[model samples]
Target: MLNFPLWKKLMVGVVLVWSVLAALPNVLTPAQMENMPSFMPSKTINLGLDLQGGAHLVLQVDMETALKQSYEKMEDDVRAALRDRSSGTRINYRGLRSNTETGIHFTVLNPADVPTVKEKLHSALTGVFVLNEGTNIAVAYTPEELTKMRKHALEQTLEILRMRVDEFGVSEPLIQRQGDDRVIIELPGVTDVSRAKDIIGRTAQLTFHLVDESARAGHRLPAGTGVFYELIKDEAGTVLDKVPYFLVKRPALTGENLNNASSAFDQYGNPVVSITFDSRGTRKFGDMTKENVGRRMAIVLDGNVYSAPVLREPILGGKAQISGNFTVTEANDLSTVLRAGALPAPISIIEERTVGPSLGADSIEAGRIAVVYGFIAVLILMAIFYGGFGMAANVALLFNVALILSVMTFLGATLTLPGIAGIVLTIGMAVDANVLIFERIREETQRGLSPMLAIDTGFRSAFLTILDANITTLIAAVVMFGMGSGPIKGFALTLSVGILASMFTAILVTRWQILAWLMRARPKTLKA
Candidate 1:
């Protein structure tokens, strides 16, 4: 234990130098970092919502709207099933409609067609119960199926919310499900609260519907057409007028087939949203445009028509562009939401809070003060009690902190207020191993052992004890990180990193320092 290899010493030196350099960015101002070389270690620890101050939102998912949408899709499927003639002759149907309360209901014109219709519906629709009374048929989702759909909707909403937040480019965002129908979002460093809310709440449900040219907007004589309005808004987003459009109820294409979307400039240098569809979407869109060469296809988003462009030719390659009189920000936001995909259901913000930068500054100051004072107190106490060896321990403690910061920065971990508390706690615990080893050395010295043998025996004896204590605490930290949410996880992460760093410093670093000193000084009696 007393013998130190040259390679071990070199390894220790490399680690210390790397840690100091990696942790340097935290101490430097942004302007100073900019002045430094580009290849230098410039990444810093990310601050959490509590440390940086941003938007806090609690959103409520509208499950009823989701159910209604599902029923509408089911109604469409049922209509197509009755019309399908591949198996046999098409069965005639009438008065087909769907609602959340009554599900989907339609009547078969021929009583003899009921059995065939039932068979086709059963084969087409899975997880639904179908019943028929004479010529009337009612279809509803099973209880298990409803539960499954709700679960799936909630999960998809969470995933889409995460994707939207990631695209917004906020750092260290905390997005998690709060309850069955609620989502909690924390966006750190986000200044535009209204814009964030708008982006998050917009459903971005995109669909393409063929325009009904013969049907007027105000006069509704068409059976399978609906009146949709296109809002003409200025750059400030205030609607000036709403031009009504008569479009087919069933969409020819939906955003589900979209592969990618981006904001780009048109031929005239105007901002537009360009979209590409997947292979499935490419085939369907090609067929639709081929069938309706002279008709207009309206791009509807969230019940509003954005554009109604005429199909001059069959568009191939699955690419299309939406040109609206939009500002660059609006176009970018629309492309972002489209690329992130639409929310399965509508969500409303039930609660919202904006955290001020001043509060974050105060919290950071408070945490810094606590860490500095606590660290200084520990250093002073160790030096006063153990003399030269205590000073070595204090040096090791500093390196331990550097290691923790470097590791956190490398892992891109978020630093919260509780994380600071963990660091403070680590500062005190870092010296425990040195204290134990020093006490053991004192006992060995009293037994008249040589200084070198006493130091060696002390470290060896205390090694197992130090390892056992730190390992248990490390396990607890891992458990906390795995089981706890948001703030608790942050605390646990810092604590876990601190434990590993402290072990490296207390056992290896301080031991190396003491051994090097003894080899040079050749002390006859230990001062520790």
Candidate 2:
């Protein structure tokens, strides 16, 4: 321990210098950071909602509606699969509809057609159960399948929501599942609450359907056909009027084929959203447009018609645009949702909260005072007990704090009030390692061992104890971080990082400092 190699000393010096450099930007103002050279590290620790006020939202996903929609789509697929003329099996079906409680129900025209229809549906639907009840057939999903689907929908919803929030430029937003069908979103530094909510809540389900001109008037349609109204709103978003459009119940194209979307201005300076499709969508769209030239194609979003433009020619490039009377913000939001993809299910805001900047300021100030006081208290106590050795421990403790902050900044971890408390706790624990080593050294010296021998034995003996203690605590911190949410997770993160940093500073850094002091002074009898 007394003799330090040249490379080891250089390694220690390099780490401390790099940590300080990485942590330097946190103390600088925005203008100062901007003015600094690009080579310098400019990353800073992200502040949580408690430290920087913003919006807090609790959302509940409507799984029932999602299940209903899934069944309805499945009903359409079943009808189409059964009506395939190339299958060689002739079957007739009618009254195809989905019941919320009974799944998809339809009537077979003949009893003998039931077996073929069932076989066809089984081939079409991979993971669903098909049953025949009297003359009616039902396509049902098992509980396990439904549960799996719901779980997937929740995970997909979280990803899409995260993408949307990130595109909105809300840095370090906390979005996590709270319960079976609920999510919590904390957006720090968001000022436009209404716009944020609107973006989060919109489903953005875009579809293309053909207009049913034959069902205009004096014509009776099929059982499931109905009219959908598209509302016209004023600048204030008040419903001024509504236009009714009759469309086939099934859509020719859906948002699932979307590849990209962006907001742009038309030649007339009106905002619109331009969209592009993937390869398969391109083929489908090209075929549809090629056959439907001179006919109207409805551009519908979330059951509302945006436009019904005549297909002048084949759009082979798979690109289209939706033009509506929209402001720049509305168009931007629409594009954002389209790019993020539609949510599998709708979400409703169950709770909303806003924290003021003044409160955040107050909390930050209080936390700073607490950390300063706790640090000073530890420094003074160590100095009084261990004399010159305490000064070395103080240096290590300071570096330990810097290392913690540098790692957090680099990882983009959010710092909350509980995180501050964890740092304060770390200050106390950091000195404990030094105290153990110093006490062991004093005991060795009392036994008439030389300073060099005592120092070596002390470090060697205390190493296992420190490792065991810190390792156990680190494990606990890891568990807490994995299982906890929000502030608890923040606290666990700081504690885990602090434990690792303290192990480095207390054992290696302070040991190097003491060895350097002994080599320079060459003290025969050490007081510390």
Q: Pick the candidate with the highest lDDT.
A: 1
- Model 2 residue pairs with clashes: none
lDDT of 2 by residue, 464-493 (tens): 999999999999999999999999999999
State every prediction's TM-score relative to the real structure.
Answer: 0.87, 0.91
Q: Residue 513 in model 2: shift from native, Å?
A: 2.1
- Which of the numbered candidates is closest to the native, going by highest TM-score? 2
In candidate 2, stretches whose alpha carbon ends up further than 4 angstroms from where it belongs are 31-38, 85-89, 214-224, 293-295, 310-317, 446-449, 524-528
